[model samples]
Target chain A: MWRIAIYETVYIIIYGLYTVFEFICGMFEYVYQTVFFTCHEFLFPSEKRARLKELVSKIKKKPKHLTVLLGPEDAEVTDLANLVIWCLASQIVFISFYDHKGSLKKKEEKLQLEVKKHSGDTAQVIWYTDENSNLENGFKGSKVHVKIITDEDSKMSAATITKLLVESENEDFTIENIHKHFVKQFRFPDPEMGILFGKDYCFYNYPPWQMRLTEFFRFKSAKSITYAQFLNLLVKFSQREQRLGK
Target chain B: MSWVVDNQLTRFQKFCVNVIKCGPIPRHIAIIMDGNRRYAIRNKMGKTEGHTKGFERLAECLLWCRELGVKEVTVYAFSIENFNRTIEEVDTLMSLAKEKFERVFEEKDKIMMEGIKIRVIGNLSLVPEDIRILLAKSVLLTKDNDKSILNIAFSYTARDEIVHSMKTVVEGLESKKIKPADVDADLISYCMYSNQSPDPDILIRTSGEVRLSDFLLWQISQHTQICFTSVLWPDFSIWHLLGCIFKYQRAFPGLKKYADECQSNRKKLNDRITSFLGDIEKKRMEQMEIYAKT
Candidate 1:
């Protein structure tokens, strides 16, 4: 018992010294990084973005077919766009959905600028919510190949969704028909997968067809919320190992 | 004719409508309502005054939620950690809760008496004797209220809930009331503070923070979460509440999960309703035609 007491005393002293060292290291680490991500990044009293960053970098090495959903007003989107272009330029598939309205001339011009900025060398698909276009309640349908959902106003159909649903089902309900319908709504001729961004998870049902038990991550911000953070989100989601049949 | 498809859809607007239409809307919604001090200081006020204003806001929000079909609303009124605050402010908060609860008991107002049941969740072991007794009486009198439930997580926590359940479950096992095989997540959950309330369908927080802060930690899962940063708790209005619900609808879209793509294999739920409505419309039209022909 006395030996145990001495062991505990030595253990406490060593841990105490280790704790002090960690505190000093933590202060220096935080001091180095001033400009972090958005308000949600700092919401946690404990700033632990480093663990998230480490995970994101791990995913980047394996480099699966990745998509980055873009928000129009956020600085984080710009930071991400730049990160992909500068670092893992070939690894990522940067996608965006912005307002493709106004004069046919002005809309096209705006799309050109946005595509150039956000898409880098990656492919771009601008949102089309026009009359002749196929959409089920603004977004969703058989025609869409890629589903890029973000919290942008011009991208969602709002309350007119009921009408969009009515239109999507103008024909008889069939599996092949529904598949065709979704393809038309997304407007992406060959969109293989869908990606939801972490910036604004206020999903107004974009790509309403595809998001059946899809994995999601409320990611850390862009600047300081490193590539490893994104990688970690993917890793955590991959490990969940759920069967969708239920 | 007003269906102008030329205009574009914004992300926030679409997100709002989709989530509300999804699953069963929560009849009783609970919240932590944290960051009033941070919010108040951001608006330039003393820390102590923030809680005072948040209290008044809480009173008004109860009426608003009741009117909006929220049967019950629970909030973390005070926590065990809150006892660590300055003695003067903690005393002031205790007195305020006692005074408010007393009025709720005495007031014959329909809003106070009708169906709205109020309960407090926490360890009462540490509360003052008078305050604890008053709480008990308030819970007793409000037991018959059927309209809604308002649960306050004062000094409540998930860890305590787990410990409390463990003790009870252990006793049951020792007494041979429940077998070991019956031990599961559901059994432990049934013994939780939120077992009386349906799992919160939607959890909303204000002042823009996203962490759960140990509030309803066990009860919330896959529930639509909405955190509005710009709105403070006191100024949290009906309009904003509508916005939150609408946003909740947009988040969950309930569309695809129902789609199944195999329409024939799946039960036609909506088409059945639409067909029913169509038959009613048809019968009415036929009767009107018969009348017109006559």
Candidate 2:
């Protein structure tokens, strides 16, 4: 019993010290990133677009489908629109935005307007919802498809698809069939890259069926996301070698 | 003097561990133990030797997690994709797995005392018969213990697990045992191999991998904290475990809030689906009954 008491005392004292240490480290990182990002932005204001374009050109392998996990703190529609325009510029055909609260999904029109404003006549933006919709065939030249995903799209789709397969009498309900259904339903290929804009690296329930081989990266803050950071992430994605369980 | 210093160093380490225990600890932790082969190459050892060292590290990690009050742990022991490896390596891994399960028998009394329940979550049909028997025996032996759970994801992939769950649901529906209304996210989750425990609170991947690599994609929610470390599996230490736990503690509050919100949202979706599919459920039951009669 006395041994337990001594251990508890030591634990309390050490825990206090540990928290203090962690706080100091966190503050230092925050300050460093703030200064560095601000200086980088100020120092290279005019060359930002060209540099981003150059970085994009340098990426040999670009992800066809990219999913962004937006945290509550980073759910700004304007920032999301900027990301969409960036994806268009980089020739990424499919981009999906996910926030747990479904706040972006509610304001889909405003987001589309924002994207239109930024993308102008350079790109055709198609908002994809499901496979059977006529919008699925609307893809043509210079087309970008944007999906606003929420928690409902993950498990709910699984249940609904399972129900459909179970009810279909003539069709063979196999894994491959399910995969085809999902591809048609979601109208997007499996995400090759996923970026999380949050303080931590949680997916927040991004579609489980789609992220089997997705390489995920994290951005510190969505509010201060820069072109360089996005370029760096693309470079990182290009450099990664996916073994796919081999 | 060296021995004395070592003793004191270990004592301090113990003290540090105790301090960490004062914070919020993850109830369940999952790990993607990567870079065993890399460790082997780096150390100029055979691949088998690296895997052996990785297994030793796993044993050490389990002990540390138990000490820290983590109730459940799931590890990516082997993947279905690993079947593509060289025949010699595959045979070695199978033998190694067989040997480990045999040791489980030798340590039965200790395992029982520790109250660790052994569970192998994956497609068991893929394994050889002998290793499968040993795995089944270990699971049966430790079935009653409840103090902690060790889930070995052998011959597993997240896609395979999801498919397995969907197959179960589909089979149930075909047999008229389950209704269409009953198939929801929670139900699908319950059908998963790792459904015995809650979703992991923290998933740590060693060797600097930022990908889930087909591990627990459905089970991990938006709130599951992920920690990617550059340490190889064989080189992973208790300090690394402690560091992961500390990070989990710092993020616990935000994670809990997000988890709660997700739970409510899931419930709402389930309820909506149930109501919407009520008529379809009746029609499906009738169809199944007729099919059964024919």
Best by TM-score: 2
TM-score of each: 0.47, 0.87
Q: Report interface Cα RMSD per prediction.
A: 23.3, 2.0
Runs of candidate 2 exceeding 4 Å displacement: A1-54, A129-141, A170-174, B1-9, B264-294
lDDT of 2 at B218: 91
Model 2 per-residue lDDT tens digits across residues B124-143 = 76888788777777776787
lDDT tens digits, residue span A116-180, model 2: 89897746888875343335455555778899776667877888777877667525545577788
Please write out the lDDT profile of model 1 over residues B1-294, one tens digit for every residue. 110112232555333323332323446576667666766788788765776677766766665565456777778787766787778867977987777667665663553445667677776666776677677666666766778788878766544554454444444445555555444344444556555676555667775443344456555532334343457775675567756654444443442232222123323334433443344335433543443233
Candidate 1 per-residue C-alpha lDDT over A112-210 given as tens digits, one digit per residue, 9 for 90 to 100: 454457544433333343334232454332111122333222112211221333434343333344345444554443222223344344332233233
**Clash count list over all predictions:** 50, 1
**CA-lDDT, candidates in order:** 0.49, 0.80
Give the best candidate by lDDT. 2
